[model samples]
Target: MSRLALAIPLLLLALSAHAEIVIGLVANRGVEETRLDWQPIADDLGQLLNQPARVVAVKNEAELLASFQRGEIDVLRGSSKVALSAVEGGKGEIFARLALTGRQTQYRSLLLVRRDGPASLDTLLAHRQQYRYASGNPDSTAGYLIPQYHAFVRNNVLPERFFRSVTVGNAEDNFRALVERRVDVAVSNTDDLPKLAEKYPRDYQQLRVLWQSPPFSYDPLVIRRELPAATRSRIASFFLDYGRNGPDATRAKEKLYWADQLDGFLPATNRQLREVTDLQLYDALFRLALMPELDTSQRQSREKLLYRRYDQLTALLGGAR
Candidate 1:
């Protein structure tokens, strides 16, 4: 009886260790594209963990958050802002950061305007209401937050109130709208610079960068904290070693598979998220300051909450490097 009891507990523990993993992805290039691009990686990860793994591709910030809230997602690989929220809301932690093959580990936000419509940033800003805008997901560091803070709010312009209209989508869609002349300005990023050149060469030529925000680290892989620490360490080791040295004879070249995304990953911690977090906090404070409709009492109360969260972020992550 005692032996059977011990074996039952062991069986339960082993089965729990192999719990199915749901990896969350943001379909930045559309759901099909995102899945096609990531399925190989997910398959490989499941192989390594010896566990069944699946992916859930989300199209926007809200969907991503909802998946995390429902406990349906066990992992994430996306924007730093999204990672920040994941680390907070999902009780997850950063495990690895994707290394861009030949590029800097950090990328900057880009504000693009049609070459013929608005000649320059100043022209767009000066005649803001005359032009429509296309932006990235609000939770995306490059798309909505950085440009809003750098070009709009700091200059006393609020996008929704200043532009003739503002539309939101992934970078590719927003760029498409820009090329089709549906929107006058689109916020893109350095990471997509090469992609723009290749996929939309003609349209790429017709577009010009209006502004660039400060640098931000690349997307990170965040996993829920309930995973075993040993498993997390093994996963980190897998990424850190995956793309280095050269292609393996047994597998296809990472360059061929991931394009610019997989140069291998650098093991990371939550500290790497601080820079974007700083922007997120300051952006809130600045936007609050610029809100025309915020009465003194509401402003004060919101400001108090924002600052409290700001302080908590600072305390938890330390100040940005």
Candidate 2:
């Protein structure tokens, strides 16, 4: 090979070395907040991996999945639903999950109101139309999915018709809406409650938890399945070992526990998203339950078919790795 040919190979190798590895961060709260919270971790991962790492903050779960579909993201740390979608799409796999003080495998959705607004869940549901409601995006698990079924559907009160008005936004927006009394009722979850407290201490203090949902799994760390095995191993090890050892180990551990209220990460699999799948099923059930036009026989037929599909999926997921 001539000198030019050899140089060309070397140049290509150098260019590839600097190619950015995009880590998709779902901005459920908003892009700026997501970037602010996750950028440092992305920087550390880049330096450790000897590759250019960039955080591609996407607006919501839909955009995150779209980006992954377009091959614009190499790694992702977001909701379990998105993680499961990636795996189902055959492009990704879960390697780790957040490990907090307790309930590492689960988190809960919450219904909140001003301390004096509703003394109890019964009061709120009894006088449902007297108040405005702030709900999380339709895509939100805690804000919309869980509570929509548990609090609204189960009670036979549709928020859309029951509330005087409804506003859709992120957890923070809904929290602020409640604190400002912009909305009489708001939905939130364990994942965002602590951060909300940090931002609005006195305001947070004025609120009361009206209802809480059953626990579900935390989000997972997912990477493109096509990534080199060595690269995948390094990324998983990085999360699992974070703050566990290093000269700055103590400080790192403290920040992990204090700032994020997370001890570290635990190894996780894509199958852990079973409950989220179940939630989606719950959403389907919500739609079916609300179809008042359907005759009793038709509704019963649909319910049976739906439950059959649900059983098959539960069995399928239970059999997955």
RMSD of each: 2.6, 3.4
True-structure Cα RMSD, model 1: 2.6
Candidate 1: where are CA atoms >4 Å away?
A: 1-8, 245-260, 291-298, 319-321
Overall lDDT per candidate, in order of appearance:
0.77, 0.78
lDDT of 2 by residue, 219-252 (tens): 7888888777877888888778877777866766
TM-score of each: 0.89, 0.85
The C-alpha stretches of model 2 lying farther than 4 A from their native spots are 1-17, 28-30, 101-105, 254-259, 292-321
Q: In model 1, what are the clashing residue pairs, if there are any? A: none
| Candidate of highest TM-score | 1
Clash list (residue pairs), candidate 2: none
Candidate 1, 1-321: lDDT as tens digits = 999999999999999778887778777676776666766766766888998877778779668866776778877777878788877664788988866757457888888887787777787788847999998888887787788888787787879989899999988888899989999888889877667678778878988888888777888888778777887776676666665633452263463246345566777888888877777777788778877798999999998998888777766765646
